[model samples]
Target chain A: MSAPSLFLTVESEGGAVCLRLAGVLDYDTSDELAARADACIEQGPRAGELHLDCEKLRLCDSTGLSALLMIHRRTTARGITLFLDNPPPFMERMLSVTGTRHLFAPESGKARQSCPDEVRETTD
Target chain B: MAPPPGIPVTRTGERQASGVWSTAPHPVLESAAGGVLTEVNPAASRLLRGARPGVRLADAAPAWLARADQDLRDRIVNGSGDTDGGASGWIGARSFEAHPSRSGNGNVVWWLVEDTDRRRAEEALATERERTAFLTEASHVLLSSLNTDRCVSATARLASEYLAEAAVVVSPARGGKLPLAHAVGGQDVVRSLVAADPSQLPGLDEALQGFPPVASRWIDPAALPAWMIPEGYTGTITSVVITPLPGQGVPAGALVLLRSGGQFTENEQIFARLFAARAGAALSAAHLYAEQSAITHTLMQDLLPPRLHRVNGVEFAGGYRPAAAQERVGGDFFDVHHAGSDGDDSSLVVLGDVCGKGLEAAVLTGKIRNTLQALVPMADDHQRMLGLLNGALLNSHHTRFATMVLASVRRTDHVVRLRLTSAGHPVPLVVRADGRVDEVGTHGTLIGALPDIESRTAETVLRPGETCLLYTDGFTEARGGPLGDEMFGEERLKRALSECADMPAEAVVERIQMLAAQWVRGGGHDDMAVVAITAPRTNHLSAVDGHTRGRYTA
Candidate 1:
């Protein structure tokens, strides 16, 4: 049998907490991350910022992407900031392809390359 | 420990009392020098049935005095004066502690205090603890496995370990016949228990109606099924507990626990019911997962690319690997469809990746696949077919788009012609016979985004040992490096492809995939696909060929 597919590590940096994700993020393991995100949202007042560290993330399926979107919605509703840091190229491609890249703020200047905020809309 | 509140001790530190001794609530028996009961108090008369004047103390309660010597009373009063913290023994069904008191004239009075209530309370506590431990063990075993068969076996093992000498789990088969999933302990005993149909047993049908577990009366081994009562089987089967595994709305299975002689306790029956409930819940979950996987598998089969068949001059091998954890078919797919009949070889091979991974992308993938399959007749003109596919994608209201590579492979004797087009996808690679690699720089606009799609077709010819590879971006976008943030990159892929010098088409594809999978190392990578078309290498090449004689020299 395959081992548990997702591993999450939470670290508090400055006033923000970063959830570093490793292994797979798919249908079976996405719910756990969603619950963790919800818990962070519940502590919104004290949790200055919510950041998902994708540096160690190996893969993210549509369900994993949807979970990120859900967390974005929750944080936005609670008037908190959410960041997606150092996403791999394929994950960036998925967000850009699906036209949902604006939901999360990327750390560093990585967002300036490949897919800029401009040229996002296509000519009819 | 001190004496009772009103008891007095003499200067010698021995317990001495006057009226308190005779009026004590505990039973008192006095024996003279001859070991005969000189007097029996009212409590003593009620405590021991044979307690009376002129009766021997040992005769009144033989179990209490069995270890007592004739001088036991004398030793308790004079030698130790305490009877070794009082001798404890059972008189009939009651437990008693005998304390001896001497009256200075060599007369010893024995005080019998009943201890049955304390012993019964301790036994009850011990039984409760055992039940809790068993329940915890059963829970761990039942919930550990998602497999239905394993869950069934776990249930039976738990029943045998805690509730019975032998246990069996019987589940209803699709037909009327019943199939046993798991059995523990004596196989013969389990077989004999199965001899009598449980449905015909009295009160069993009602018990299975979501009622409590019911116990069977002592069953004669001779009355069991012939197979159960083997030759020289002398062991007698006493009783069995039948507990139903309640399903969603109906009972899914039954648990049978066997015993040889002892009657089933009420607590044991309750534990059996709880265990059955856990088994039922786990079975229900396993069944649900199986049903869902079946549905997903059917959808996946429909979305998967067809196997590549042999075209006379070319050997084709293609594979699709989905990066989705549980669902194998995501957005990346490839297909090889032959448009020409028998010897006249003309085939259309297309590989594409929808924008995302999952159900939505999978749905889009199916749409693109079906459209390409329908356009095979007109596929001879690669540009026109792609134009039609682009128009079809633009017509959909959703913003979903895909990157694709379309190849038209034609064979004439020893030579094969290829025309390739790309819709904003990565350029295809060609592996030369002498271990050199060339990139076919094909360019195009993204399929669904543009109204008038501009795509350029790249043409190339392959010798006998040459091969062409077409794949999605998942190949180069896989992320794993020394720093762990770098992509696998096109340079690594090119180097890896060059290593498979003289391998066959299938072997070439497998080598590349194996390298990529190793690089990914089970990390999260995008869905990947590769299609290799190799011309079989003969002893000597046909220098004078009928087809186009163009070479791609990187």
Candidate 2:
């Protein structure tokens, strides 16, 4: 009833667009934001520079995880990198256990150094 | 006799100094009684021009040298062990103090200082390593578990590895000969000793029967199978301990550990037993979860609308998503039923949202769903059909209230008479071909909330391209939205309908769902039941559409 409660913000930093997600990301919002991300990459962004800011994002469940997987796949296929910046620990653990840590690869490489067995597949 | 006191920080920094600390050669003071220089560390040796290990404190520095530096004499009179280990007071290289033990039978005094730096670093490293190992094991199990068995076996292996147990066996609590559920290592010299005649394994069946695994001392080595005692594994094996699982009715099963030298301590037995109990419980839960998911899935697939009811002129698209979250099962139903034998006269469209979830909710859903399906064909108006469903819900006290909307769409040429009956359901959003949206506000008290439900019916007209949408609270009260703070009021829904009015029935539902998503974010906060239907514009399309029912989307 109230203009779909979610609001979107896009910020540009050093030639990269940092998409800040301000609300819950589940089944209801998956398609719209996913669509938005897809369009952004289509408009041309370098790999590893297209970052998603989820500092305020409140929830991330299995459905949201699946949606993220979809975006990850779509972005990688186009040679564009997708970064999840400072996601809440809940999402971080979900991604870790699901072995999608490679998607949100920590810049410092701390956890990654502990796990050398991360299987890499060039799958889009 | 009280031991003479001046102690050194450590042997590492030996140099010349006075007062038992030195960076340079200075003076060494003595007690007033004999001018005794009782404490001398290696640094004092430097004052003696490198006095070797056997050099006594008095020999390293004579009292005659102390009169030169009176501060050295004062320290000789005072003895305290509080100085930090590494940092010794830097006087001259004349002396280093003798260090005394902090606890019992204090015998050795040396120039060595305590190393808190190294000790703290080691402890911190150990703590971090422990956490990393735990996370590693958790991730391994979480990502890989596919079925209940794999879940237990994998996690059991992880637990066994974590607990560093000799064995971890997973066995069905139900009938199974192997008392061992899973095993790692034990007295058996063989690797992965599976199928061990069940009788050969120590404390096997005995533990399953509630007795603990026979302690190592109680078990006679001669009694074991010849294969269990291989030549090389003799001493490394400490003892064998068997622990019983907690839950009852488990087929005779227990965890058996093998140690060669020592018997299991009381605490170890308690821990082994407790860990096994939790493992079994978790296993049972995982099994139940898998079973329930399979059944709920199969049942929903088996029953779908056989065909959409055919009335002259309309298009329709409907979607249903069962409460997908593990905690709940939503029982929401919708159907377009026609009582008339001919294609033109009348049809009833019913949609309802049942309260609660799980096997019980599913059962009630099936009952109400089937009962209404049977009752609709006999009813002339929507109200009569709904009253039948309400009676069925009232007959059972298993669940609280359910909201339902029943609509009768009748057409005899241009005028399509729509009679709506509601038992506490969302008012259907009506959209015109001109993109004008309005709420059909056809709502009534929710059924089963109270004994006597006051069902209400409203009449409306469906001209050429006008469509009406019926949906459950799941859509409006999505997780991220303000549903919990306030009801997802009908006003907002009506506005959405008016904004996207000209869309087809399916698109309108999809868009409304999208709008709900936009309002609440991505969460399917509750179970959603949605339907959108347009009165067919032509007799031909209506006739063709009548043969098909609602579609199921993944």
Candidate 3:
């Protein structure tokens, strides 16, 4: 009857920061995501790219999408590039359907590392 | 004399009878058979005034003691043993118990023992128990209704019945006027609002301000205002106690008690305060609930979606279901704005879903709808209007974005012409007369996201018996089925739309909503909304009367 609870973990390797989101991101859990994103942005100047790893994300509703947009605004204001790393099938479809995939697309001349086969299938 | 019938002739008794009667602590009296006192000890002579030898018992002592003495003598003469217990009665201010015994001279000696302290204590305990029961019942009755006026009336009635002959419950002053509920013993409660000043009576102003009550002895009952007394209360006000009805944080009101007889004892005053405490809490809760519901009702009126109907000669219908059944408004919203009175036949129909659900999302939708309404003059240029809307949203502080579909519809002859555009929203689907469904190709980035937005508006036409369907993502994304996790998907919506060919505008909207609702099957969902625009089928025969839109024959 209720969605799976959301879990977020922050990991920094070398100069890049990765915020991994798991479980459900709906109306109830989207605010927490926004809060976590704000906290990460508060940490002083770091890497050029802030990656949101969505490999384990099961669902993202409209609210969750709004939270992602908020995070993009924060990262952009700080002169950091926000990236959608390892987006699952559903997440990729949501991004493309909402026409936000270009905002999080990989930079030019930087070959994306290990794009999911399902992403290629959907895009085709 | 054999110690007169049942009287014991013990050694101690004989000794007391011989000489100790003069120094006995309790009162002792000897009476003859005709109710005349023959002799009296020193204690008896001191206890009963006007008592001496040969005096009648009835003239010296209380009537109850004289009658008790006569009954005992009659029972003895009748050869029946005295089976009744000794009589107890108040003598002056103190209580006494009288036990009868026979002395050596064949006369009855009555011994009286004082038990005033014990009797007073028992009486106090019984009064306390009765007051406790009354307070418990008062709490139950006062809390039964959340109506503010009802709680006030109940408080007045309860105080009248238990505390005093009449009571008045004065609500907190507003605009120099106070609301009052007055109740009298064995009478119905009357409510009124009076402009009289509370400070007219001593301690009333302080009580209204939630201060501890001034003692009843300090307040003169003659100072009470005429409005404070209930009509038909014939008794003169002898004593009055004014106490504050303490509420959450502030005082709810004050209670005024009126009595025609004795002053309220310290204990009764304390008990009145206790009853006021319960009544105040109930009244405060009821007042808070009334205020909250009134505020919610006013706000919800603006956020609720309007019922769609035919606009500008084109049939328009809409259906919406919030994610939560208990909620009336949510993130999804739709509106149909008829063109200005400039003779233009086109109307702008807007449907959108804001991020999230419930009241927070509904607030955002309200902002978007207002912005769109202001931009209705630019309805001809869909791209320009969306660009302005997008700018407005980005300029604001909202962290959210919305996906919206806009359709400009106008009927020409038997066909409906439509200019459809999607702003990061689902494209409109057209259901043909023969049940063939087609998706209008329109695409754009969602509003309030990127500064430089791009959209492609598509033009289409609907023939008679054809309909255009616009919906939110909540339709295609609803997750429920035999598996309970599968998205309803665009393919399923298309298939469902294909079956609704040739149906009326309202019927088409209803069918789509029903199918999506069935798919969700009471599972968790997002806010779903749908709007249908159709060209009415021509019915020349029915149009002859011209009173109504002809019924569809299909």
Candidate 4:
């Protein structure tokens, strides 16, 4: 079988919505990503939780990442919790290199407790 | 005795006795007793313009010798011990030492002197030579390494050491950290050149604001960093000239050099400025190169896992291809994950395309894949996974989309659940164990179809000897296809899959890439991604012992 296309998946956890992404998220897909994240925030919690699933994600460009940044800003301002999780090695490194790792997936104690297990159970 | 190099050898007898120990290209004079010419070197003859050796030493030397020590005369004339007592002091004179020639005894009192006026001329010559050597080396260093920070730091260090001036390096940090590159100068003066707060030092502030490689001076320390005034310098700074350091883009930071003792001369300051300017360009280029490399490296690493995750029962063979040749690689990728505990032979294989390409698409791809990995365990079925993925993608961002084939293979029961969803993406090709070629087209639109949209699952069994191939549009859309332009279309991919039905995932990817590559001659028209898995349904087992069966589950 051929490999699948990139994906940006989102969900709800605790008081905020969750957004997860897989595959290649780039300029072409960033718009869709931006819309999804916005929907999560506009829907409830005055904020949302962004969980980026990088396991299957293969690539991302600056523009794709910028979308994530936009989502982060939106959610943070509205008191949403962004818990980007399971980032692929590549995504994690990029986030760290660009100094945005903390902004997206803050350490658990930094904000609200991350319900990783809970999110896992729900999403799975 | 041999003379030092460049001192020009001279014979003793040919030496001019008229002046006191004056000789050689650059000389250090040691006064002899009575200045009666107890000894003379030939260098003196050259200095005296070939004056005869028999000329009276005392009268032939500068008349100022009359005021010299009386003991000098006593030691030379009477051979008394006082040779070591001779002292040296500057005279109110410039170049070309002169002496009075008397018609008295050849035992004349001589004079010894060195014109301090020539010191500047000599120093300038030396400085010029050193600067040339330094800049040449700097050029080489700038071109060799692709590290921006190192290049900048190296250039600054070279400037500081070569020019013996305050060389400062500054770059804007992403956060609040006020990270200054570096500053090199005299311990006392360099501190003022480096101020933690811009407001604390007006001179430095002006220098930083002026442009890169710019130099500015504070005639008084009142406007500079506090420590610069510890002793309170007296000498007025001569000049502060800022030669803007060029950054590839916007200025990252500025180099502030403060000269407190002697204001830099016009030529010296110009040279310093030029060096800084060149260094800045080199640093910018190096930074760009480094950034590109880091991105490439990161992309490559991100494309593949550091180590394989062992999925029970089934062997995972997947490969990811990002357009490495492109300026920015695409986000196309694939991954094989342990959807269940290692204790079980249930694995989830996700082969798909992230909507779009380049960095953004890559990010979305990563999110979907990671989310699937976290959620697949609880997903229970391909449909549940699709739902979770859809939900996660919908929440991750706005308007992001993708196409994918998520399959759960259960090795224990030799069963597979395959689902294909396209958010405007091409469908995957499947090859049965018996070489039955089929395309699972349009199971649904690609991912990110809509926040609430759910894709139907494609129910298919991976019988023994069956292999499935998942990939992105870059495959069927391979360039060189002008409508009917010989594109490596779906037909070609299906044919290739049918041919390599038994090959492992990695091998299948390579084979297809090779075929496509040969067809394209050299380049990949678009980013191509592939995933292939072969599960031996019925065991051709030796029945020899206990071997774990491979299993995959969704």
Q: State each candidate's clash count.
A: 2, 54, 0, 133
Span of 10 residues, lowest total lDDT, candidate 2 chain A: A115-124
* Residue range B298-321, candidate 3, lDDT tens digits: 767998889988765678899998
- TM-score per model (chain B): 0.76, 0.58, 0.74, 0.54
Error at B116, model 1, angstroms:
2.6
Model 3 / residue B406 / CA error / Å: 1.0
RMSD of each: 9.2, 23.0, 7.7, 20.1
Residue ranges of candidate 4 with Cα displaced over 4 Å:
A1-124, B1-146, B153-263, B267-278, B281-310, B326-329, B341-344, B395-398, B413-425, B451-454, B481-485, B537-554
**What is the C-alpha lDDT profile of model 2 across B1-554, one tens digit per residue?**
12234544333222332334443232222222233333443444544553444443344444334332233334334754332232232224222332232211121233323244555576678855774676555555634554655644554455445543445553533443332334343222122334455456556557656564566567554455543333344446556665665443553245555555567766556555556665555555666668777887777664443344234445556666666655344566677766566555567677777655555556666777778778867656556666666676664322244667887777655545677766666677677778777667565655543344455578787675678888886666564555534435466777778876555566777887777767656444567778777764443433334444334334
Error of 2 at B335 (Å): 3.8
Per-residue lDDT of candidate 1, residues A1-124 (tens digit): 2677787766553446667677788767777888887876786635457877776677876557657766876777688888888888768876664445666776756322312223211211
lDDT of each candidate versus the true structure: 0.70, 0.55, 0.83, 0.56
Error of 1 at B210 (Å): 4.5
- Cα RMSD over interface residues, candidate 3: 1.3
lDDT of 4 at B532: 68
The numbered model that scores best in TM-score is 3
* Model 3 TM-score relative to the real fold: 0.75
Per-residue lDDT of model 4, residues B40-94, tens digit only: 4454544443233344444544444434534455655687664434333333344
Model 4 docking grade: incorrect
lDDT of 2: 0.55
- Residues B328-362 of candidate 1 have per-residue lDDT tens digits of 78888899888775546688889887766677788
DockQ of 2: 0.01
In lDDT terms, which candidate is top?
A: 3
lDDT, candidate 3, residue B264? 92
